[model samples]
Target: MNRDLREFRRLERLCLEQAALSTMDLARTGLLKVADDCRAAAEAIEARSPPRGAFAGAVQALKRAPLAWRVGARS
Candidate 1:
């Protein structure tokens, strides 16, 4: 990837990290709005820079499993 794309990827990684933390909090609170916001964060990252190869499946898994359960291999 180009320099600009690499920078964008870095930003997206930050977004995903924040989203993960938010999701954990939302899950504990059981608040739909907060959970939705976290989900939106994930969507925004996907929009700007979709996951590559093995990570593509990981992103999909996050849609189903709880954030805490997203461990092990990339996929």
Candidate 2:
């Protein structure tokens, strides 16, 4: 999922770059629209997804827990 997000971002950049280089108004407008759509999609996905470090945060929280709070703690 992270990889896919990065790919969407990369595609947005590529579209913007190509738009900058385009000589025709229509082509540039189309490319810019495509880039905007990619950016919007990426933002939407990112907003709905957990942060990349969410798993690490969970692990860190577990580390802070008392030994007895961990799994398989003895009675």
The candidate scoring highest on lDDT is: 2
Highest TM-score: which candidate? 2
How many residue pairs clash (N, CA or C atoms closer than 3 angstroms) in each of the candidate models, in the order given? 0, 0
Q: Model 1: residues >4 Å from true position, as ranges?
A: 23-75
Task: Please provide, for model 2 over 1-75, each residue's C-alpha lDDT reduced to its tens digit, 9 standing for 90 to 100.
Answer: 678789889999999999999999999999999998887678656656654597865754564465336434755
lDDT of 1 by residue, 4-70 (tens): 5455555655555566666486553544445455555554555466556678867766754654454
C-alpha lDDT score of every prediction, in listed order: 0.55, 0.78
lDDT of 2: 0.78
Off by over 4 Å in 2: 51-75
Candidate 2 residue-wise lDDT at 55:
86
The TM-scores of all predictions, comma-separated, are 0.29, 0.65
